[model samples]
Target: MRLPFPSLSTLPPTLAKPPRYFPTLISHTSTTTTPYYRPLSRSLSHPSQPHHPQANHSTTPPPPSSKMSSPAPAQYVTVTPTPSGYALLTIHRNPVNSMNTLLWSQLQAALDRCEQDPNIRGLILTSGLSRPVFTAGNDLTEIFAPMTSREQYARFWTVSNQFLARLYRSPLITAAAIHGACPAGGTAMSMACDHRSISLHPASSMGLNEVAIGIPVPAKWAQLMATLTGQGEANRLCGFGKMVDAAEAKRIGLVDSLVDGEGKEVVADAVRWMEKTLRLPDVGRVITKAHFRDRLSREWEDEEWLRSEAEGAWEMLASDEVVTVLGGVMQRMSGKAKI
Candidate 1:
């Protein structure tokens, strides 16, 4: 059944309050800083897919085989069909689910498989296990790899942008269940989804802190952040590169709500929410979602903008300053450098 667009009168009291802006928590010389909270418009199941809820999933682990994308290693991603006709894509990379070219390809493959399956009504995107850190963002080692040419850097940015476009334009309802630290690219992935929820914990922080690490948030990404938080706020968070806790994230509208539990509980909560959203007629939900989001998707069609974004992304990766900062971070994470 189709429902009318929600109005102010229909919103809950907690949401009706005026948006409260928070001061900049992180400072970046080139970055800029807002307080406007907009009601985030936010969506499940499939059968016949492997791991279908009805399937007597093998007690024995399955062999590694490419099931999703053409040639990408699919080991990093898993797709299971829910009884409700939704697909659950679990991001599982050891240590941390850092985004690499392979992970990106695998993720896109999982998305492609679920989107192509008519039985799948929606998608729940989340990490594999309950970890303190959902994903530390991109694999900085790969991102800061010794680049011989701009084309190499461009390829990396292109892969990232392409996958992001898929997430942004997916016809199926998508939700992100974030439980731990979601920064930079992780933040972008969640924002691309139709709805997002984060676990309530002091360690749980989320934001597009790309600039803090020397990467420029692309135009489309920038617009997505702006859509949730005002333009100035987007710049402040992304440019200054700061991570905000779950409470602040919810208050700023970065997340729709703060989940009470951690790990699988958080995933279940998000899945339940998506399942509820799926009760609405798919036709209306899909159309209305597109109506609100297609404007930003169309921005990718601009050839000039794409070229500029690619060039700028490459420039950031190639900059001596950016490389040094990235290298430093990696060293710290690896315990090669001390505070």
Candidate 2:
């Protein structure tokens, strides 16, 4: 029996246009026989496919793109300050704000700016993408690309985890105004915040369901989830990679509050909440937050260890098992799109 798939004219919003951050591959053929081979857009020569262990031999993937050494975009995130003594840092890598090295660096910079500036008392994280998504997740291309070197993956991991560590431990009051479908990295960032105020829109949900994508959630992520929802619930949720709606999230402590509308209304509610919180004496809040969250944050502190972990990430993504699983997933989606 033929599986149901989207007609060519009716592609999903995510598949309609290629993601800018993860432009590691571009379709070069429509033939069903193209196999699961992914030709790296940057180094098409590699024409990489997972070296299935069952095969007698396979080609080694090439090094990362030369463009990696080039300067990244000056503004990958935008900082918009409000009169409410809070600033909104909109992840500006649009189409889908998949956190890559550039986004991580830019986000770190934006956070630094907000904290250093006397005018900004707190900061909120949101998305600049018009779509109802905070972020799809970390750009998987770094792992999936044929030209992805271990070093490159290491850099990507280090930069992103560092930013996340900082976000978790930020001195300024932090909040995530989750406006849409948040998964994986999006949920991690939201968890990093002091409060998660989410939109009640049906399109909005949150989860650490990286298992669905064949990704391993870092231990720290699960630890933080446990901190919020308790060890039993965190184990159940992360173990299954389940996504939860706003109501369930609020009830489970995955989210602190829910706003009635999406977009500006939700952000406004978060700002209002932040304003009220800012009224409290600042140092007490900061230190108290540190007391509870410091241990988890400290796990990501060592740059060297993170780099070593990145090698493991490279192995996981490029492994025979992950490649086969993710390949099947991509094939189904692309096949659906082509139909």
Candidate 3:
């Protein structure tokens, strides 16, 4: 059966072009209108800095790129402040915002900075661009690249788990504003947030399909799914690799609120509802989120279990069947892949 949405080759507006190098830090300055991406300065002392202590042991400046005599234009993740002291964190990774290792690291840094900033109260995770997809999910090219070794796969899980854990444990409220196909890791991402508000786009498909790729879902992600929809439903969905449309997702309680249109107005309505209906001081919001997420954390501390699980999953990915299936899907959509 043909999928309702076009293949990934047709780029959507949300996916930003690739960065020349991964950002060392991403900060949303309260003074600025958008989040800024910058290389980590040697003077930086915070853990939030994208410069992994393990990777950068020297003080030498990065060599200038010969490809560009001129500095590349600064790319910013759009941030809009809300009355509740929270800011909407829109992913502007133009075409489909498929999550990659570098983007995931940048997002981790961004969230860390958001948590530290006293001016920021919470976050609303959404796509800045109109979409056939909020996130097409993980960037399979990066995941299956020959350069991506077993160790790298393990490290990817470590970074991803920690990043997601931070989101779940954040003191501030975080809500996902989902619109289109939110599959695989994208589903995990939405579940990491405190709450979710999705648009009822008829084309939208949201679910976990790891099994179809010959991989088991990460333990933390599986637990989060169970927490949201209960053990029975989580098992049925994850086991069979079911993909549910927006209406079914809503009926099954997978999505909190589904708006009529896919536009800024829909997001505005949700933000307004959050401001008015979610009692302020935000302490209650934080506490309630913790109540649900603590269980997931307790099960995956240090992310040891998740790392081990992902390693095994990566091994399965080495199989021809898994590689062929995933590659064919991605290749068909290559033209549409975000630049």
Model-by-model lDDT, in order?
0.68, 0.71, 0.65
Compared with the true structure, what per-residue lDDT tens digits does model 3 show for residues 169-219? 666667788887788887888888767777777767788887765556766
Full-model lDDT, candidate 1: 0.68
Q: Which regions of candidate 3 fall more than 4 Å away from where they truly are?
A: 1-76, 145-147, 335-339
RMSD score of candidate 1 (Å): 13.9
Over 4 Å off, model 2: 1-74, 145-147, 332-339
The TM-score between candidate 2 and the true structure equals 0.75
Better of 1 and 3 by lDDT: 1
Q: What tens-digit string does per-residue lDDT give for candidate 2 at 108-200? A: 667655654555678888887788888877776655645467778888888778778878877678999888888888898899898898888
Writing each residue's lDDT as its tens digit, candidate 1 over 74-185 gives 4777777877878778888777788777677777656655654556768888888556667667777556745335766556566666677767866678999898888878
- Which candidate number has the best lDDT? 2
How do the predictions measure up, each by TM-score?
0.74, 0.75, 0.74
Model 3 vs. true fold: TM: 0.74
